[model samples]
Target: MATIALPRPVPRYRSSSPIPTLTHSINLDGINTSAACPIPIPNKHLPVCPPGPAPSDKPDTPPASPPTKHLKLQPQSLLYPPTNYKKVTHNSSAVYLIDAAGVAAAVNHISQQPLPEAGQVFPWLHGLHPANHVQQAFFVARRKALRKTPECYRGVTIVKADGNLSCSRLKSAVTTDEFMQTAMAEFKDIDPREGFSVRNFQIQSAKTAMLSDIIVYGEDADEVLRVGSDIAKAQRSRRQGLKALGHEVPVYHTFVCTSHFEEFEEHHPEIVVLDTRGELTGNVLDFFHQERVEMATMTKASEIARNVWLGPTDDLSMSGPSPDDEPFDLFIECSDLGRANVPALKNIVRELDSGAETSQYVEFPSSGSIMPPSWPLTEADDIVESCKWIYNLANGIRPSEDEGEITDIEGDSPMSSPIETRTSRPRKILIYCTDGYTESSMLALAYYMYAHGVTVSEAWLQMHIDKRRNFFAYPSDVALLNSIAPSILSNSPALAHTAPQDVTQRIHDEPAWLALMDGSLPSRILDYMYLGNLGHANNPDLLRAMGIGQLLSVGETAAWTAADIAAWGDENVCVVQGVQDNGVDPLTNEFDRCLAFISMSPYPPSTPSTKLTPPPFRPRPPQWHINPSPLPRRRLAQRHNLHRRSNARAVPLLPTRILLRARAPPQRHHPAASALQLRAAEVGGDDAGEARGAGEEGVGMGRDCERDCGDE
Candidate 1:
């Protein structure tokens, strides 16, 4: 259970007597804190921070929201480098160390370790930092990132033991989730909604060294060290017994933030007390943005704020700034004040993001569609290191000093000179489609088509059970995937042998209810603008569906005029010269009159107006611009070649967003031409008066689409 279960009602205290009576309470155990000092103590004799406030202690005053300023956002191009962040201010460097040998009993026994001379140190990997706030921040981010991939099993902590046959015995494969509820039952309780999936896990056996007992519920790192020391002692004692029997210890320390926050309220930043720390802080600072994000979200985490013990000296320390402080700024006095607000101040350094300023970085989309921001990376190399870090610790194996060191890096940004980069495998088990309405269904069809050796019809039939929506794909996407299907299927012997010829023929011969076909198909159009190559100028179905009984095809031979005949014509496919890129942009020159006619009144069969009396002009939904270049499939193909055994074949649709013309604001055509201009600059594009052109009716006012283009 999560520790946050809302507060017991705020107490109403009377001041009748000289002394006030106490009512409100928490359950923090009292600790002896006489050893704290302003001077830096050696890592070997570190001060102990408590876990949280006591039951009877008063709750800290809640802080107010921060002041916000409106900022404009510019369009960002895809397939480019990640947004470059301004350099972050470095204040205090905090460190967390896990005693592998577990020898530390008191702060006096805990010797601080220096940074490795080589390779990278992923801070989120070990969860062994001295700074309580910093470590917790990384932990929170890790939880967020992991939740994005519930289906992926790479990091799941599995305690696999069924009454074991080893030196140490077991009962079952208890997940970290189960273990936490059972083991830490007394310390913290989590609500299911606030709870996170289990990333770190352990196996339980009768002989498994119990480190849980050593962890004092309210005591901090010193207690952790004492627990580690006891575990080390147990491992040493069982060395011969385990070595002769050929078994490694199953008990190991995996992190769980069971402790509450208020334990370390007075914590503050001091100097880097350890010598020759090397690039210790360097690896951490490399992923500096992640740290900034975690800290930023802390401001909104009122539940954690009111209950959890945090250092008083650092940003994580609970804050009660004066009202004069920026409205939402919690720790106003921290040196890295601006840095802590990095999440909120994204527009300060304009970068390409989905929802830069408007979003608060938390969303649980349906069917788990959204991906987590990177931190606890799933890259093959990172996973290898993470597995090594967690498992080897359990097995009493220590990595050599030079083991996981990182070799490549530059300042701030990690990219380097034009080295050929290998693209990663597909993102997950489902194909991604841009149109949200049909993405889930499309993914289902795609999975069956590619993996099951089924014909398009069969695949559609398999997927049309509950989610039976028309799945649309660009003609090119289908062709590309179809071209590669044979090769992939041939390699899968079982699939190849089971694939039937007549059954496959029936699919094409019979036309599936959910077939994957060209966009020209009548069933494919989600709306008028998205008519991929599904229809031509004379297709009645297309004209009828769009309610535009007429199509004023530009650059084709037909009449061109803005009369009622043109504006309200049914079954009318008229051609006009100078329509740009197949009538995509009606706002451009020449076709303005025809576009105006269409905008003025409803098309045929729906209040079919015989005369063109212009009503209010309403532009279509905001134009969704997509990068047609390098195509999604092509990009994925280049990233990695598909093979028989590769399961990471599911590719997400390339992202698309509103570009040149956004939806018209109320009583206004668009935000301002400036918005479009800024978008153009980001993409190195030219709108040719596009932003102002569509919304402005001055040119096409009262013009008739009555005449033919050839005649004109």
Candidate 2:
């Protein structure tokens, strides 16, 4: 592993661009009411109460009412009602903060055509905000629709949803390095420097998704009302023509809340209501019932709200709890719940048991044998417990006496005798969250580990590379998963017959260094060995901690004095200096010496040392043994690159540019665990970065760094 030393208190990487400013004002009918009725930001003592627009001048329009009370609004809810036509337009998919009147204006403008009998209309509230009861209740009555088709070319789908491109931490742009420093600082018990590079690299390497917003109404006043009217006119003509021929038309889904149920009932008297008020359990059932819901993709929406209301700071540290603190877990059947409204989901298992004829419907069961209703999977303990629970449930273990089989029902039907005639259905577990990206990934990885009986690194590669789903898993989360993976995989049903002592002893005997790495590897690649550059060969303390009694260096010599060599033993340490790695150095000639040196024991000559010889490198499945190939330099480089690619394919997030043959493992005493176990030693230097290897395909005698700077 190559090591680069970095100076303490890392250099500042914040951008120097001018900060964007947001202004709030009040508009009363046609009059400017900013001075008289200024909006106040939410405080710790008071709920967010954005001022309503001034009473409309029109005779048919009712006067404005006082803002709602008992609302738990975000600090960013200093919004004012949109006064003009431009305020209530929907041009983009980006979520905007709007009041009930604004929503009505947009929907009314879009609904130029009369509705067909089969046409469905629903409003989807996008972002988190305070539940203004009056506004949410109004969407229940609207029967408007707009149809805008997205254009696709090549493989890219160009969404027409309105809003400017934005960042999650956009209020003040913070570099990935600064963010990692702050994030790593929180786990003070662990060495912040450890895995800092990998975590930084992970975030830097990921492509940030699209996040847009509608902060102010007055900013984009010149777009004229074409967004709503033109879309509405086209939809109106299409609906009329379709209705004439009794053809099926597109359904309308608008963003809305269930705030004012009475007003909704009054407006739509023909529709009967079953349940108006339900417990706010903060699950999918309460999606519309929520007074406040934030889009998981738009993290900066909340941050902007906080900056506008609470105040802004230059520090890059994350405020409050970790991202996706409120976990919403779902264990659904793929056949059932395939992207449908929660309300429409029915119990298919029960229906099948009763022999009831029904249309295709999916089921989403929770709160019993399935899993918990809510789990903030930030803590490692919580994650492990949840994973174990899922394991039991999936394996037909009723976790509690009160809980029953997931498919179990109370009564046996007369059709039960004919159940053998029905086709068997394959059951699948689908772990999902509100946004389908942020909060569910940890649980997904955990489930993968138990189901696949592989390391967390393998699970991660399969999910991101094979599944191709973008998920947000913090380094800390990955570390936690790695540390618990051995235990979790041991519980696999495949090992049910294995002796308890064998499994327990393996787990108990796992090297301390294994926890610090991101991937699982043996304690020793070969001999009392580690693969590193001169930097590592010189760090006596690091060598001692890693339990390395011998060192073999190629091309570069270690900075060891005679005294140092005497301390370590001249026989234990060997360096072939003055050999350049620029594709000309004959590494094959030195392999015998290197192998012989590696064969030497750290103990005195009296101690028994295994007779070591270079093993031929061969690619094999399940477990591939990497050894020095006796081939020439060019052929050896090609073979090593192939090996590196194969190993790197198992974990895509790892540094792929370079492949290292050997790495240092973490000690048992250190509680830190990462997805990979490699080490790069960094000496203090301003220009310190990843150590470079001068060879074709970036293969070097010294491998890439996999430092285990994990916390205790």
Candidate 3:
């Protein structure tokens, strides 16, 4: 009933010549430029200069020396100011929170300057004039003054997505392991490792979002313009939307820099400038140790500072006539502002600063912790002194036996005239930086810890998740925060009378498992189990710090020496030798051993289903056995048909006969054609048989048909 046609021969080229010749070749080296352009244009003749009066009639004069260019420093008053200020937070308090842009805007508005279009001289915000070198220098210097490092990482960086596995490996792991499904669901919301949480934990809010009393901020320097543009666009869209709804945009009073503290106080006495400037002046000339004369002559930023505050030229000096006396009103009340006490945080910054020249590890006996070299480390006493000063300012505490008055050599109030002088804490305060995050972040973190009774971890999460501010911190900064956290908590008036709670005791009593959640150890696989590379396994101290009791090495063993083992006393270490990370190696045989080692750990898995318990022994299933002798070819089809009839799902036993027929060229009368018909009938029953019968009647079958089947 069926026919098979022979396949056509594949075409092969035969050489007409004895030897093969190259085809489609071009002579690249023999390009004829002259032929392409037959005639080149002739060069134009040079005109001779007209004869001038004889040299003897004119007097020879030496060329006048070029006049030297003198740098003209732009006055602070002349610098471009913003027309309107954007409030960073929606806290309807006395103090207004604004960024550098808002500050410049406020200063311009308070000074009663008209908008640039209305005849104002400068059309740009201070330190934002792209064409002005002086403003740029001052802008760069002011931002740099507050930071120990040049760049920082912030906002949804390096976060893990999906379940706790790489996207590529997740498919297979989930497919093979039933326990993984349960584990994945359990730890979905929970952060497996700490430092930063999952991207879901990052908060996104409107421009008017409440950013508490403090905020940590940092980002790569290169991203400043892009990020600023994005923020501006978002704000503009929001403003437009609000206006369409006929709602009025709120405006708050703001001060430009600490330099105008007196004028600012006069207009808004309730707001305070929590100065967090670092030790560096951020002056470009300072790096080369330029003298005062050179700076005064060549540096526009320095000249601007001198113009604003006549008394001082140095930016780092704490002993100024007033806070505003320093260049650009830059002052360092605290050297390292906004440091935290989290180890995971410290580890992150330290790694980031690995190649930095200034970063160095320093141990502080006061905090009983080592400050990572990623940031500059300051003495504990200096931090304490700064804290005390802030405490006095906030609480309206005057000069007492313990603290000195903030005075100048003249014994007069430098902040204001004696008649206008008053002693009370500012009701509102703003902590900000030129760039979005870095300069202001640390100071804000410090303020939060000192004012609130929370530890570094709590403050970090609170600001990021609750307040909705993204910030970055260096390890040294965190270490300093750790050192000073105790004093801050104890000195905090809010917590003085309150009973000890979880927050107050968290610094000392945090659980060991917290390391995994916070990113102190390597990657966390489960609550009890962790995953790490060979490098991490070699560090016994790191494991001990995280309270990791056992080490299970796969693929590669740790490079641990005798001392490493001693340090990790009673080490429960196991290695799966000869297993390489290359995809070829099968981990099937090592599964039981690995599971046994993991289960033997003192720490139990978080869920019962993921416990990796051995299954109860049972006898082999009878269906697994195979028949030794095959049935004769003649009986095969009958047996297969009977089997299929008995159970419609049963497999047809025509594979061997089909393979033999496949090796031979197909013919119209081949007996193997019946085997295919039988297979089709088994699969689809009478309908398939009818279809096959129609196919046999309609088409010819041959080697070409077999080739098409093979291709499919």
- When summed lDDT is taken over every stretch of 10 residues in candidate 2, the lowest stretch is 303-312
Q: 570-591 in candidate 1: lDDT tens per residue?
A: 3233233333321122334444
lDDT value, candidate 3, whole model: 0.29
* Model 3 deviation from the true structure expressed as Cα RMSD, one decimal place: 39.8
Task: Judge candidate 1 at residue 710 and give its lDDT.
Answer: 11
Reference-based TM-score of each model: 0.19, 0.24, 0.22
Best by TM-score: 2
* C-alpha lDDT values of all predictions: 0.24, 0.30, 0.29
Error of 3 at 387 (Å): 4.4
Please provide, for model 2 over 334-418, each residue's C-alpha lDDT reduced to its tens digit, 9 standing for 90 to 100.
2112332222211333333345433222222211112222323443344444454444422323333222223323333222222
Of the two candidates 1 and 2, the one with more favorable lDDT, higher being better, is 2
What shift in Å separates residue 592 of candidate 1 from its native position after superposition?
7.7
Superposition error at 415 for model 3 (Å): 16
Output the better candidate (1/3) by lDDT: 3
- The candidate that wins on lDDT is 2
In candidate 1, position 52 carries an lDDT of 77
